[model samples]
Every structure is written in C-alpha cells, then in structure tokens.
Target chain A: MRTLLASLLILIVIPATIALGIVVLDDRNYYFISLLIILYTMIPFAMVFESRKPQARELIIIAVLTAIAVAGRSAFFMLPQFKPVLAIVIIAGVSMGAEAGFLVGAMAGFVSNFFFGQGPWTPWQMFSFGIIGFLAGILFKKGWLKRSKALLCVFGGLSAILIYGGLMNLSSVTLFASTFNKEALLAAYASGIWFDLVHAAATVIFLFLLSRPMLEKLDRIKTKYGLIER
Target chain B: MGRDSFSTYHPAVNFLYFAAVLGFSMFFMHPVLQGIALFSAAVYSVTLSGGKAVKFNVIYMLPALFILAAVNPLFNHAGMTILFYLKNGNPVTLESIVYGIAAAAMLVTVMIWFSCYNKVMTSDKFIHLFGKIVPALSLIFSMVLRFVPRFRHQIQAVSLAQRSIGRDVTQGNVVHRARHGLRILSIMATWAMENAIETADSMKARGYGLPGRTSFAIYRFDRRDRTVLVLMIVLIAIVLAGAGMGENTMRYFPSMRMKEQTLFSGVVYAAYSLLCMLPVIIQLVEELRWKYIVSRT
Candidate 1:
C-alpha cells in the first residue's frame, strides 16, 4: 500500500500538478514544464521503486516493460512505417489489467513528451493513449489476444490511432477556434486525418506482422520466469 | 551531482515560484515587459547555470522562432503600412510584421522563462507538494517521468546489442528497416507486458490505493518560503490587475499604436516580468548562499 501510494504520488499526481502549474503559469510553457517534470522527477522514482522492490519481480518486470513501451512509442518518431506504440500498448493491456494498461499508455505519452517536449496537447495525448490501452485490456479479457481473435487486435490498434489522432485534432481546433473558421477546422481535420490514417495503417501492419511472434515470446518469458498466473 | 542543488527547495516556494512566473508572463505584454522577461531570464540562467545555460536555451529558441513565424502571419493580417505585395496581391503590412515580431518575442521569452523554471523547480518539490492529493496519479506520473530516459537508454542498449550481433537496423533499406523496427517493437511489447504484470503484482502485494494513505514529504515551508509566497501573491495581484485593465493589449489590426506606454503601465509591466523571474532569482540566491556557507565551513 505504501509503495503504491508512493508510486501514485510520483507518477500521476506530480505530473498533473506540473501540468496544472504549466497551465496556470503560461500555456506556452506547458510543454517545457511537463517535459522537465517527467525527466527530473518520474524517471528517478521509477528506478528507485524498482530497486527497492526487487523481490516483487513481477513489478520490476512491469517497470522494465513500461520502459520498453515508452521506448517503442518514442521509436515511432524515428522509424518510418513502424507502429511500436500500438504493439506495446496492446501488450500492456493483455498483461496488466485495464487500469494498468491505461496508466502505461497515458504515461508513455506523457513521459515520451520529455524528448518531444510538452505542450497543451500532452494531456490529450495521455488521455487518448490511455483510452487505447484501456480498451486493449478490456478486449484482451474477452480473449482478443488469441490467434483466432488476432484481427480484432489489428482493428483495435487502428481504432486507437484513429481515435487518438482525431481527438488531438479536435483539441487543436478548440484551442484555435477563435482564429479558425469552419474551413480552417475542416482543413486541420483533413490534414490530421491523413496523418492518422498513416499512423493507423502502420499500426495495423505492424500488429499483423509481429503480434503472433511477440505473443509467443511473451508466453515463453512468462513461463520461464514463472510470471504466468496458472 | 549536487544533492543540495537538486533537492533543496520546499514545495510551497517552488509552487509559488511557478505560479508567479506564469501569472507574470500572462499579465505582461508590452515591449518593456517582454524585454524584462527576456533580460531577467537570461540573467537568471547565467546565475543558476552559468555559461552552460545560454547554449542550452539556444536549442529551445529555434522552435519558438519557427512557431512564431508559422503562426503569427497566418492568423494576423491587420496592418496599415504595406511592406510588399504577394503574387496574390495581399498586402504584407508593417503592423502585422510588428505584431508577428512581438508574438515571436513573447514566445521566445516564455520558452526561456520556462527553461529557467525547469532548472529551478526540481522533482522533489513536485512529489512533496502532490503526494497526498492523488497518490495513484502521482506515482504514475513520477514513474513515467522516471522511466522515460531510462527507457531511452535501454533502447540504445538494445540497438547497440543488435548492431553487435550484425543486425543493425540503421544500415538497412526502407523495407528491411521496417521489418527490423517491427522486430524491435515485438521485443519491446513483450518486455512491457512483463513489466506491467510485475508492477501490478507488486502494487497488489504492497496494498496500493489503500484508504487513508499517508505520504512522507522531504520539503518544508520555511520563513524564506513564506516571504517568497507573500511576494509572489503581491506580484500576481499586480500582474492580474494589469491584464485586467488592458495594459497588455497589443493592437495589430487597422493601425499600430502602443496605446501610449504610461508610467503606471511601465511599472505594472516591470513588476509582472520580475514576478516571472522570481523563482529563478530565489533559487540562484539560495544556491549561492549554500555555496558560500559550504565554502566557509
């Protein structure tokens, strides 16, 4: 309980506080502050928490996995035609319950922004990714990760990208609505749709190519490490 | 790493400092105010980080400039003094250009100030201030922030390992690179899944999200913090008043007039900009004092 509370304080509370701070201080500085908060505070805490609870090998695995999920999402920026984010998010959902998946997805977005920088868009990114991961978890519980149900995973990944990107565009419209007309909104949405389509398509392709092998490997790790609940 | 430098601030002081800088920036919009913000942020950077900070700020400045250039001209088309005509015959007016410059300046100023804010406001302060309010959320935030760079480092390590094994994705063609990237993603996904399970089990075992949880804070509100908070409140009040009174309003459309920079306006603007720099100033002073004391001791 103590550890969980501590993790909560370090992860969600501090970031949100910093986000609020950024908002109250200067909307423009939102990105910088948010990035800083993540870099200076959250990263170190994760290391410490993992080290302290080494006996909880599962939690340590989760921390490392969460780190990989973050790395995968970040890798998306550097690699063309790659959708590491969707793959890792789905993996998080399958392993961790819905809340855990949501947190990982949200944190992945929030923390990755440290490299990309934070902005007014960070929260929306968090929310969008969180929802994606959460839904993945829900679907996983319904046996979505099974080979027979693999197409559903692809659809889920695509839906997540589309929804996240679409919502992000909507938020941009809201922010710039004072200066933007319907034409501007339409243009923004149109441009955004193209990016989202690419993102979604990439996610689907990546999942299709990789999910089976990835799941097999994960099941092996779970078995080898005695991480499987059975 | 200097532990004192990283973990010395009380949460209240840090919070006040953050609020002061943000409130002040929002309130001050005049050239003088902007200048103050720019100059003070520069000085604060120099004091807190010495020469290294200036070089660091340059990287952040590039984006601010790009954003200003891209955004200002697109939205604002109101100006009287026509500089040139586009092929489409739209007049590029002086007023719009000036507004663009001002907007750019504001953006840059905010960026610099934020860089300073980031330097001064440590994670310890944030953890202390928000630990109890929402523990689960805080933990998630801290863990993510904490893990991201580590995650980056791990990715680099994995990439290096792959290169050592003669599977370097960097040297591949587009399609090969895509496949390699997928392989990396698959590995990463497997890792994330395992980590989530571990974290969940640990949290469950540790009784996370228990009712009536208590947090331990390393930061304390001292006299200096209190004084800073009071000053911040005063500065915020002044800045808010200025913003409320339209002293910060810049007219770009129709004609360019600065609304006559009054003495009152100047003072208000100065105060606001100073408020923005307050945290940086406080941190610098504290660091210097600590340094002096340590040297003497």
Candidate 2:
C-alpha cells in the first residue's frame, strides 16, 4: 500500500503539482502544461532505470536529442523546407517504444504551442502526434527500422502526416462546425484541406532528410546503452 | 485560530470558489461586469504577487491580442457602424470589432483569474474540498496535473541521449528524417511498456483499488472558514439576483438612446466583478497578516 502511494505520488502527484503551478504561474499556456506532463511521465521511467546509474555521457546525449527533436519540430512551422515533425516522430518511435514515442510527439505539439498559446486545438495535437509515435513503435518492433527497410520509413512518414492531418480536419469539422448544418461542415472540411496538405508535405520532407543518419546513430545507442538485449 | 491564516478556510468554501469562478467565466456577459472583471483581475494579480503581474501579462495577454484580431472578425459580423468592406464583400463593422475586443478581454480576464486562483488555492485545499464527493477523480486530477511537466523533461533527456549516437534526426530530407523520428518513438514505447509493467506490479502488491481507501488531510474547517463561506454565498446570491434582473429588463445589446446608467445596475455589476476577485483579496490579506505576525514574532 505504501509503495503504491509512493508510486502514485511520484508518477502522478508531484508532476500534477508542478503542472498546476506552471498553469497558475505561466499564463495557463497549454504548452507549459503539456511540457509538465511529459516531464512527469518520465520521472517513473527515470526512477526505474536509476539503479543503472545512467552515465553523465548518456544524460548529455539524451538532452541533445530532445533539443534537436523539439527544434526540428518547431522549425517546420517557420520554414517550408523540411519535414521536421516526421523526423522526430519516426526517430522517437524507432528508438523508444510506442509510449515514449507518443509522449515525445505529443509533447512536441504541446510544447510548441507555447509560442502560439493554448486553445481547443492542444488536445487534438497531443492525440494526433501520440498515435504517430505509437504506430512507429509497432512497425519498428517488426524489424522495419533496418537499412534494407527504408521504404518502411517513407511509409511511416506518410502515415503520420495522413493520420494527423486527417484527424485534425475531422476535429475542425466536428468541433467547430457545431452550427449543425451539413453545408457548413463540408465547407469547413474543404477549407481545412489546404492547411492539412501543407502539414502533410512538411512531414514527408522532414522524414526524408533525417532518416538514414538517425537510424545508424540509434543502432549505435542501442548497443552502447544496452537498450537491446545481447 | 486567526482569521487570516490559510488553515482557516473550509473545504466547502474552496469548492464554492472554484464553481463560481468557472461558471462566471463561461456564461456572464454584461459589459460593465466584464470591464470590472478585467480591472479586478489585473488589480488582484498585481497586489497578490507584486511584479509577477507583468510576467503574467506577457504570457497571457500578448497572445489574446492575436486571437482577438484573428478569430472575432472572421465569425461575427454583427454591428451597425460599418468600418470597411472586404474584397469578398463582407462588411467589417465597428460593432463586431468592439464585440471581438470584449470577447478577447473576457477570455484573458477569466484565464488570469483562474491563474490567480491556482496560486491561492493549494493542492491540499483542493484534495480536502473534493475528497468526500469524488475522492478518486480528485486524486486522478491531482496526479495528472503533477506529472505533465515531468513527462516533458524526460522526453527532452531521452531525445538528447538518442541524438548523441550520431542519429542527428534534425538534419535530413523529409522521408529519411521521418524514419529516424520513428526510431525515437519505438524506444519511448518500449520504455513506457516496461514502466507500466513495473507500476502495475507495484500497485497490485500494495492492494490498490481496494474498498474503503481513506485519505488523511492536513486541514480542518473552523470559524474563519464559516464566516468566509457565508460571505461568499451572500455575494454570489447578490450577483445571481443582479444577473437575473438584468436579463429580464436591461438592454445588453447596442442601443441609440443614451439613458443614464442606473445606480442599482452599476452596483450589481460592480458586485459581480468584485465577487470574482474575492479569493485573491482574501489570500492577499492573509499573506500580509502572516508577514506582520512573523515580523513581530
């Protein structure tokens, strides 16, 4: 009972407290709240591996990877040059499991929105990015991350964009088109397609640019960190 | 024993405070009331935490301007004074602009009020307030709020570690980059699964979900709480009565006639706004008293 309480406190309570504090103190921005959630979720995972004494080198590597992923994800919004989000989601998924991937992708959306401010769209972003990661994990577990399976990478990129863009369009129609008119719903969906297309294209470009080097690096990490057994 | 002490508030008072703030933010619409609410929120925030109010404004107020500018004009076309016309033939009216400003102001004000309330209302108070009605949900909400930040930090750590292995996912083509991103997701999933298994095992061993789980809290309802609760109820009642009367008789819409604003209406609107700021005021006074007492001691 005590252990359960402790776990609950560490996993849920402490993080919630910090998030609430941020929400209260930081203008109630959903990005800060989302960031808080991701950090909190990681606590238990970190604790589980604490006995392993994650070397300073490993910690530094993790920090850099997170910054790169977040920076890449945010850069897509500014420049039409790359598929930053797709790269982050695929790499996260292939290297982490579905849950971690989901958390990272979702957090990317959530954290990025701090620049934009919180809105009804935050939860949808979380769900969309989360599923992207989850899907990547399933594919990776099936040896899809291998160099010979480069097509799998393209498929994953296209899939993430399609799923995220499609769901967002649906949400825009359902949530915003509450005028209860079919015409209004159709119009909303139609208008939304352009934005979704832009997002989808961005995802494809991001993945195409970053996949190969990221895969080789992840394989190396798996070996060094003993992430893969034998 | 002191009236200004944090421990003096009852759980019921905290609950009422939460309900009133949430409800008012969602539904109230009088212009005077809204203006007062905006002012009171600003005042309360500044007084409660000194210069922290400026930080709050940057984080909350700046974005509200963009939302007001972008969203309000697009949907609402209701106004008498036509400002201009779009090339597409939609009339840009003065009234819509005003209304949009009002809506944005209201949204920002409500958010600020909630932020202030979050600071004043501690987690222990919330846990105590809702423990009886729905302990499980309260516990869950508390936990979720606590963990969100930690989760963000962990993702950062993991991402950095993955990047160091020469998997710089940030520098590549769209398709190749996306595939690399998938790797990160796969690693995170494996870690989550492992964590979930460990958590479930721990929970099972500790006999969670067992019947009759009792929680121990560090607060108790006292005389100060009783007085505060009575005052809040009375204030809320007045605000509601004003709202009901205004709904029946007052013209909230645009009107040509320039009739003098009635004293009763003004008082009622002021009261409503003041009620929204009551929690902040209480906390401020309490903090001041504590400081004074501590200096003397």
Candidate 3:
C-alpha cells in the first residue's frame, strides 16, 4: 500500500502539480517551480527510509558509500570529466536496496555541493543522481540488470546520457534563460552534448573497471558485518 | 574576517534573515528593489569575506552578469520596442534587454546572498534546524560530513604509501598510472569499510536508534533574537504586501509596464532594503557601540 501510494505520488500528483504551476504562475517562474518539484520528489524516499528505522551498520554503510563518492572526485582531479561518483552509486544500489541507493546518491550530491559551493542547481543535481541510483536498484532487484561488467557499463552510460545529462541541460534552460523556449532548450542541449558524452564515457569506463572489485568488497563487508540483512 | 555581530545572533535569526532576503530577491524584479538588493548583498558579502568577496564579484559575477544579460535578449525576443534585428532576423526588443538585465541581476543577487549564507549557516546549524524533522537523514548528513574529510585524508595517506612503494598514480605510462590509482582507491575502500564497521559498532553500543535520543546544541534564542526575528517578520510582511499590490514587480512581456510609484511603494522599498541590509546594519551599530565603550574606558 505504501509503495502504491508512493508510486501514485510520483506519477499522478507530480505532473499535475507541474501543470498547475505552469497555468497559474508566470512561465518565467519555471526555476522556482521546478526546484520545488525536485525537492518534493525526495520526500517519499526520506519518509520511507526513516520509517524503516535502519540499523546502525546499515546507516553507517550508506554514509560510508556516500562519503566515498563525494571524496572520490579528488582522485581524478587531473582528469576533468572522469569521476567515480556515479559508479560507486551504482554499486551501492546493486549491493544495498533501492532506498539505500537513493540516500547515498542524494547525500553525495548535497555533500559535494557543500564543498563546491551550493547554488540553484543543487536540488537538480541531487534529483538526477538520486533517480539514477533508484532506477539501478529497482532494475537490479527486478532482475533486468545483472552483476556483469558489460551490462552495468551499458546501464551506466545510458543513465549518464539520458538521465543526468538530460535533466541538467533542462535545468540550465530554466536557470539561465528567462523563458523556456524550444530554441533555447535545444541550444543548451547542443552546447552540453560533448560534456555529457564525456561524462557518459567516464561512467562506462569507471563501471567497467571498478564494478567487480567494489561489489566484491561490499559483499564481503555485508557478509562479515551482517550489514543490512534482509 | 572576524565573526560579525549579526552572525553571533541565534541561528534561527540568521536563517530567517537569509531565507527572507533570498526569496524576496528572487521574486522582485522591480529595478529599484533589485538595485537595493544587489547593492546591499554586495556590501554585506564584501564586509563578510573582505578581499575574497571583492575578487569574486569582480572576476566572476560581473562578467557572468553581462554574459547572461547579453544572451537573454537573443533567446527571448518577446518585448515590443525593436532595438535591432539579429543575424537570425529575430527582432531584438528593448523590453527583453531590460528584462535580461533584471533577471541577471536577480540571479547574481541570490548567489551573493547564498555566499553569505554559507559563511553563516554552518553544517551544525543546518543539522540542528532539521534534526527533529528528519532524524535519520540528518544523522546521515552529519555522518557523511564527518566521513568525507577522514576518507579524503585516508586516500591521501594510501596514495602516499603506494608512492613510497613505487606504485603511485604518477609512476608509469597511462595504463599503469590508471591501474595504480585504482589500486589506491581499492585499498582505501577496503580500509574505509573495515574501519566503518567499528564506528557502527560504537554507535550500536552507545544506544543508537533508541527512543528519546536527544542531540545537544549550543544555540539559545535570547531576547535579542526575539526582537530581531519580530523585526524581520514585520519587514517581510510589508514586502509581501507590496508584492500583493504588484509594486515590487514589473510586467516585461508584450510591452514593459511598471506600476506608478506611490508612497506605499516607497515604504515597501525601504522595508525591503532594511530586510536585506539588516545584518550589515547590525554589524555597523555593534562596532560603533564597542568603540564608544572602549573610548570611555
């Protein structure tokens, strides 16, 4: 019942809210409305995670994963677009459950922004990273995704391109442009396509190389400490 | 820079001030209101961080303002009075150019406000504000913040250790360097996982997740905080009243139309400026009082 309600909130209520906002408010106010929507989407995830009352070990594991992803950017400072954040998030989703995945991704986004400087884009980044992790976990649990390198890499690339790139570009349109015209949006996407491709390639590369060992490490930790036992 | 008097107030006061200012600055596109907000934000920021804020405003924000303003009229071709024709034959409109400047100024103003916010609202204050509401997530936030620096330190140590063993990230060709870097990361991950188990055990032993767990905080909302909070609310209410009267905004679409400036609008602009400049004003008053006492002594 809770899952059904959450799904309903995401599907029916959110779009309705967006449509209402568009009709009622000025189109120039897209930034505020979109930000509120992004924030609203995180509510159910937080509520569910809190309701579960996860164990200390489970919480610690999630915190550890999030911190790793946020701090992992320093490892490749020389390589501009290459980052291990999404790869670690995907591994977290595959190992832990969907809730844990979302927490890790969202927390990483928030915490990293603390270091980089928070702006209007913080919520959008959090939502993008979070939904990707949530999808990875959901797909893996449904058996549509697998533990293999080829499959995880494919998923990672597509997520970076479609979800992260797409949402961030849309946010740029709302952010920089006064009006949300098709020409402005397309131009933003056109300008950002190369950056997105690099990011996608980086994710695929990281997943290909890091997924096996990272998963093994997480599995070992879980079994050894009995973390997040179902 | 030293801790300003305003920041020494209660966190609630500080948070409320920024929230009100940021919300108002984002919504109000009236030229006078924008000018007031932008100037106050710039002054407060420079007062807060000194030279760094000046450098940031000059080097980054100034150029960004111009670029955003220039870019907006190109994309938006909405307003009436045609300034000129672009290469793409879209008529460059005066209204769009003015709207672009307003939008750019608003964005920059909000960003400067956020910069001040970051300096004032530390993570502990944020956790304090939200802890009761979202206990688990707040705990996770605190934990992650604590863990980030530690993990980064550990990664550095691991890399240094690997370097001594001739297997560092800078050791060889591209593939070898990549392999070494990955090896360091893998080692760090193993270390983090192993140590985190102990951290979790300590939390478990300390009665984590128990009912009625209370967190300690240092902030106490005193009488001064109450006064400031009330004043801020009154100012915010006045500003909202102005917004309701459409005195704080101008219609830029179709053709630009600004409401006639009235006495009420003047009062609203004053209230808005006071709301934005509250911290800076407080800081100046406090300094003056301090100097007077010191001189008498």
Candidate 4:
C-alpha cells in the first residue's frame, strides 16, 4: 500500500505540479510552485525508504553505497565524463530495490554538492538523478530494459543523461529567462547536446563494464550476511 | 564551519533565515527588492568570507551572469520597446534586456545565500534536525559527509602504498595504468564494505534505533533562541505577505512594468532587508556588547 502511494505521488502528483508550474506565467508562482514540486518529489521518496522498516544494517549498507557512488567520480579522473556514479546507483537499484536506488542517487547529489557548492541547481540535480535511478529499478524489475546487456546499457546511458540534461536545461530556462521562448530553449538544448552525449556515453561504458560484477557482489553480500530483509 | 555565532542559534532559525533570503530572491522579482537582495547578499558574503567571496563572485558568478544576460537578447525578441535589430532581422527589446539582468541577479543572489548557508548550516545541524525524523537517511547523509574526506585520505594512502610496490597509475602504458587504477578502486571498495560492516557492528552494540532511546543534544532552545525564532517568523511573514499583495512583482512579457513605490511596499522592502541582514545584526550586537563589558576594566 505504501509503495502504491509512492508510485502515485511520483507518477501523478509530480507531473501535475510541473505542468501547473509551467502554465503559470507569474514568476512568483513559478518559483514557489517549483520548490513545492521538489518537496513533493522528495517526501514520497523518503516515505518509500522508511516504509520498508529497514534495519540499521541495511541503512549502513545504503550509506556505504552512497559514499562509494559519490567517491566514484574521482576514481575515473582521467576520463572527462566517464564517472561510475550512475553505474553504482543503477547497481544499487537493481540489487536492493528502487527506493535504495533513489536514496543513493539523491544522496550522492546532495552530499557531493556540499563539496561542489549548493545553489538553485542542487535540487534539480537531485531530482534528475533520483528519477533516473527510479526508472532504472523499474526497468530492471520489469525485465524489458534488462533483456540484453546491450539494451540495458543503451537505456541506462540514454535515459539517465538525456533526462538529466534535458531537465537541467529546462531549469536553466527558468533561471535565466522570465518568459520561455521556443527558439531560446531549442538553442539552449542544442548547445548542451555534446556534454549530454558525453555523459550518456560514459554511463553506457560504466554499465557495460561494471554492472555484472557490482550486481553479483551486492547479491552475494545481501544473502550471505542474512542482513535485514528490507 | 567551526564554532560560529550563527550556529549557536536553534537550527530552526538558521533554516528559516536561509529560506527567507532564498525565497525573497526567487519570488520577489521587483528591481528594488532584487537589487537589495543582491547587494545585501554581496555584503553578507564578503563579511562572512572576505576576499574569498569577492574572488568567487568575480571569477565564477560574474561571468555566468554576463553570459546569461548576453544570451537572452540573442534568442528573445519579445517586447514593445525595441532597442535594436539583429542582423537576422530579430528586434532586441529593452524589456528582455532588463529581464535578463534581473534573472542574472536572482541567480547570483540565490547562489550567494546558499554559500553563506553552507557555512552556517553544518552537517551536524542538518542531521540533528532530520535524524530522528528520518533516522536511516540522515545517518546516510552524515556518513556520506564524514566519508568524503576520510576516503580521500584513504585513497591517497592506498596510492602511496601502491606506488611503493610500483603499481601506480603513472608507472605504465595506458592499459597497465587503467589496471592499476582499477586495482586501487577494488581495494577501496573492499575497505568501504568492511568499514561499514564494522561501524554497523558498533552501532548494534550501542543499541541504536532501539525502543525508548533518548538522544543527548548539545543544542538548548533557550529563551534567547525562542525570541529570535519569533522575530524571524514575524519578519518572514511580513515579507511573504508583502509578496502576496504583489508589492514585489514585476512583469516582462509585452513590456516591463515595475510596481510603483507605495507605503506598504517600502515597509516590505525594509522588512525583507532586515530579514536578510538579521545574522549580521546579531553578530554586530554581540561583539559590541562583549567589548563594552570587557572595556569596563
């Protein structure tokens, strides 16, 4: 029942708020409503995690995974965009469940931003990664995107980066322009296309190389330790 | 991030102050309010971190702001007052230009407020407020913070150990270097897992998350905190009410329309500025009173 409610909140309420925020032209309404939408997105995510009645062991494991995901960026310093953060998030999601994935993704952004600097973009980035992780979990469980290694990589790569890049550009539009113009938005997205492709490519590379080993280790640890079920 | 005067306040107050400044910066789009927000944020940030803030604003924020403003006229051609025409026959409007400046100012003001907040709202305060509410997640939040620096140290230590054995990244061809990096990553992963397991065992021994567990807190919400909390609530309410009444509204669609100054708007402006400057005021008053008490000798 709790999962059902969370799903409704994510699938229904979030999109509704976004549509309302976009339709309203009053800048004040747009600002407050956008923040409210972020809060709405966050509350359900926490609810989903808490509803599992996860024990302290499970919580510690989640924290460890989140830490690894945040630190994973520096491990690939040689590569421009090929960070293992997204792969780690995806692995956690596929192994532990969707809520854990969302937690890792959202918390990775939150914690890293403490070092990288927080701003208006922080919430947007958290939302982007959280949604990406959420989708990855769903896609994995449903076995559609996971039917083949190539398909999983393709979906994970294009889905996370494209959604994140696209949403961030939308936020930039709101941050930089009072009135939305189609031409301006198109140009904005166009300019960001290369970075988006690099991120997508990086996500694909990480998924192809790291997914099996990481998932196997997470699975082994989960069952062998007989940790809390949640 | 060390022991600071603002951190002495109840977490609620710190959270509210940041929220007010951020909200006003984003919601109150009037040029006067926006200007006040930007200027006060600039002053507050400089006072908070001195030359660091100035350097950051110049190197990072100013360029971003310029680029943001400059990019608008290139794509946006909406408004009645056309200032000029582009070679593509698109007319640049005065309204778009002005709106661009306001938006840039808003972005910078919001960012400055967050930087100031980062100093004031340390991770301890963050976890303290939310830990009980979301124990597991806040635990994760604090853990992630504590792990970042320690993990950096661990990575460096691991690198040094690896280099001593001639397995460092700089000691080979591309493939060999990649292998060495992965080796370090694998070691880090093992260490991370083991570290978490050990911490979890200790936490279990301590009976964390147990029933009837009472938390010990250093923060005392005493009389002074209460008074400041009420004051912050009042100021925030006034500013928000003023915004609700459209005192701080501006339009930039067809043409720019800034609300004319009125008595209520002036009061709102004062309240908002005071709200933004409350921390500085508290800092100044405390310093002055302390000096006065000491100089009596």
In terms of TM-score, the best-performing candidate is 3
Order of the predicted models by lDDT, top scorer first: 3, 4, 1, 2
Off by over 4 Å in 2: A1-230, B1-15, B58-75, B80-94, B117-188, B247-267, B287-297
Clashing pairs in 4: none
- CA RMSD per model (angstroms): 8.4, 12.0, 2.2, 3.0
Which 10 consecutive positions of candidate 4 chain B have the poorest summed lDDT?
B1-10
Residue-level error in angstroms, candidate 4, position A92? 1.4
Most accurate candidate by DockQ: 3
What's candidate 4's i-RMS value? 2.0
Query: Each model's TM-score, in the order given?
Result: 0.66, 0.53, 0.94, 0.91
In the order shown, the candidates' DockQ scores are 0.18, 0.05, 0.76, 0.61
- Per-residue lDDT of A1-230 in model 4, one digit per residue for the tens? 87788788889887877775555435334545666677687887787677655677778888888888777776565676567777778777777777777888899888877766777778887887777878877877877656355876887777765787888777776666555778867876887777778878888887887777676667667676776444
Ranking by TM-score: 3, 4, 1, 2
Interface RMSD of each: 7.1, 12.6, 1.1, 2.0
lDDT of 2 at B123: 58
Give the range where candidate 3 chain A is weakest over 10 consecutive residues by summed lDDT.
A20-29
* Better candidate by DockQ, 2 or 3: 3
Q: Let me know the DockQ for model 1.
A: 0.18
Better candidate number, 1 or 2, judged by DockQ = 1
Query: DockQ score of candidate 3?
Result: 0.76
Work out how many backbone clashes candidate 2 has. Answer: 96
Could you give candidate 1's per-residue lDDT for residues B92-130 as a string of tens digits?
A: 777766666665665565556666556656555666676
lDDT of 2 by residue, B1-297 (tens): 233233246656766875675456534544666677777777766665667776877775868656654555555454567778878777767766665565566567766666556555665676677656544334433433333344455556777887787454674687756666666655653453344335444655776556676667777777887888887788788877865554312222242122256776666666676676776677678777778888653
